[model samples]
Target: MDSIDLEVLKTAAAWLNAGHRCELVTVIKTWGSSPRPPGAMLAIREGGEIVGSVSGGCIEDDLIASVARDGVSQTAPFLLDYGISADQARRFGLPCGGTIQLAIEPLSGASGLPELLARLGRGETVERRIDLKTGAVTLRGASADSTLHVDGDTLATVHGPRWRLFIIGAGQLSRFLAQVASAMDYRVTVCDPREEYRMGWDLPGVELVHCMPDDLVLEAQLDARSAVVALTHDPKLDDLALMEALKSDAFYVGAIGSRANNAKRRERLKLFDVTEAQLARLHGPVGIYIGSKTPAEIAISILAELTAVKNAVPAELLVPHATAAPMSVAGCVIP
Candidate 1:
């Protein structure tokens, strides 16, 4: 499963390769309440075929209408604005008269999209810079901190998976979680030293490795944009990984277990010099209490909490199920 932006780029590349004229639209800036954030992309073919989105359906509809009427008139990239007036806001469905600025670049060989996709396939976070006037593009390696930047006439957008999810297990639950996370634009890596658990794991786009969890955690260089989830119930695996993950700058470090097991895990971590502050960052019994009784449901629960943290959603707003309650997953009771 590809992320929405990745899907857009891939579709655009396919259309371009087929000798079709394509135009790529990106949200460069937004004011007030906008439907999409900066760096959101939409790809349109010469015949009005579209993939991905900018401002949900309304703005897309307007773009398609313009394309059908104008017949792809713009030869070079240009900046287009929407919702600048009250009537325009109502027409485009921008909330609170929001104004969005877009950089519409007509795609061709100079766009470097195919090569950009190649780099992304190799798991490299890339910074793509577009010369707005000339419709020329260049690509370079980018760090996780890189963001969309419109400097004068040059537009720089970061592409590829900027976030990482390190899962210390290759079990059934990990498969479901990895699929969902990959679609969410997370570079997911699942590690397990046990051969029995690692066998038959064949999910594409997710890296499955046979290695010790602790060593992998140390080598991961987990930063604020990284998340570590230990789903293997084995203490030999989960505890060691949790210790390393908690010590790193990972925004989220979680472990799946029953309440009793979670308490015991925390106690064990203390003996390894895991600080109270680091231990506090650990999310045990990992996931929002949504009464999940299946592996798929549990995956959703865990991702909900993970997304909240990634977005910096306030704690009170989450209303997380921190309290003890009877929950079961895959017919196994989580007491």
Candidate 2:
């Protein structure tokens, strides 16, 4: 599955390749409560067909109508602001006092979108800079921490998978997690040394390796933008991976197990000289308490918690509505 930004870039490239004029609109800045954050994009064909969104439907409608009537006449990029006034905010369905500034760039050969797509295809994070005075663009290697920046004369946006997920098992639940994480634009790798499990893995765009999980964790050199999840129930596999991951800078390190199992895992890690602070970083009983029973639902719940951590949301806000213990069969959760 393609991310929304990827879809926009691909659609814009397709339109340009088919001899159609299109404009790329990206949110550069926002004030107050806006519907979309900075870096949200929209691709508008000359005929007003659009592939992405920058705001609620009302703002899109206006852009489409303007492009359909005017035929993308601009030769250079320009700034367009919306919802600057109370009446305009009402008209655009923006929150009161909300304002969004967009960089509307006319697509052309100078935009370098095809090259951007190619670099992203190679699994490299990229920083794309566009000159506002002209449509010329430059693409260069970027770190995972790169972000969107807009100066007076240039608009820079980070593209590609800036985050990565390292899964320590290639089982059924791992398959679901890999698929969902890929759609969320995470570069995912599932490591399993067992041949029986490795041979059956067939997901596209996800890397599968036949190696020990702990070795892969060390080789990855996980950063703050990375995550580690141990889905295998084996103590040998999950325990070693957890030990290395907990000591790394990975923002979220989790393992799948019941509450009692989680406690046991912590105790075992303690014996390995893992510090209390480092062990505290582990998120066992992995996901938020969503009462999920199936593998797919469990994947959603796990990603929900990961998203919460990524966004710096307080854990107190995610307390389950019911305080009852989760249901399990024979000391194993259904997930």
Candidate 3:
């Protein structure tokens, strides 16, 4: 599923290219239990067709009503506010004290949206800056660390997939993981030196490569936004990669195996001069342990764990806490 914000941009671009008028609405500010965060976008066409969301359904409903009544004009972008008072909040279906500030602007050639989409397609992280008074837009290459910034009548939002996943296998499990991760806006690359296993691999938004896992890991320059998951289960392939990945700054490093195999893998890594701290960073028997028994289910569990880590969830709240009963994903019965 395309995230609502990205889908909004793509739909607006399509409408613009098709010679239809469309307006882009972004949530630039919020307070007191807002329905969406800053930088959330919604696109509305001249004909009242809409995509994406800035609030719960009620907010979108109000936006559509505005378009239908006022029509999306070619004037400069302006800010709008909702739920400013108790009566207004009740009418807009917002929480008692919630408020949302929006930046709504018409899309056109000067918006640089097509170019922005092109850069995103090339896997480049981009920053789109909009001048609130002039309705002008500019696109620039951004560092992986850049985030959305709104200040002083200007809005700068990051676009494109900012996260990367390096999967050290092209097996069935890797396919599901890759597909789901891609949907979550991760640029995934699958590496496997085994030609037999690499055959018939076909998935969009994922790169397939015939390379040793260790070499790929070293070359990846895995930063905090990156992740490494080894699903090959082959010691020669997975161990070297894990050793490199765990020592790097990647936010998550994991390998799939049973509890016994994971324990053995840790013991074996110690001979390679892998330090205690680095070894502790390894997530073995990888996933949140939600009783996954199939490849698809396993993919879900891994994503859940990865998400928890990404969101900085506390240890006590993370699924299958370190002190809880251990479960193996290697065909173990839940009982």
lDDT of 3 by residue, 1-335 (tens): 45566678889999998999999988878888888888788899987999988888888998899889998878998889998998888888788688988888888978998888778778788999999899888889998778887789888888878889999999999999998898777889999999999999988668999989999999998899999999998999999999999889999999888767788999999999999999988877788868777899999889988888888998677654232375545575322
Q: What is the C-alpha RMSD of each candidate to the true structure, in Å?
A: 1.4, 2.2, 2.2
- For model 1, which pairs clash? none
Model 1 stretches astray by more than 4 angstroms: none
Stretches of candidate 3 off by over 4 Å are 1-3, 321-335
Clashes of each: 0, 0, 0
User: All candidates' lDDT scores?
Assistant: 0.90, 0.88, 0.86
Model 1 score (lDDT):
0.90
Ranking by TM-score: 1, 2, 3
Candidate 3 at 99: error in angstroms? Answer: 2.6
Most accurate candidate by lDDT: 1
Better of 2 and 3 by lDDT: 2
Model 2: per-residue Cα lDDT over 145-210, one tens digit each? 788998779889999888999998999889999998987889999999999888867887899998
lDDT of 1 by residue, 301-330 (tens): 899999999999987777444564676756
Candidate 1 weakest ten by summed lDDT:
318-327
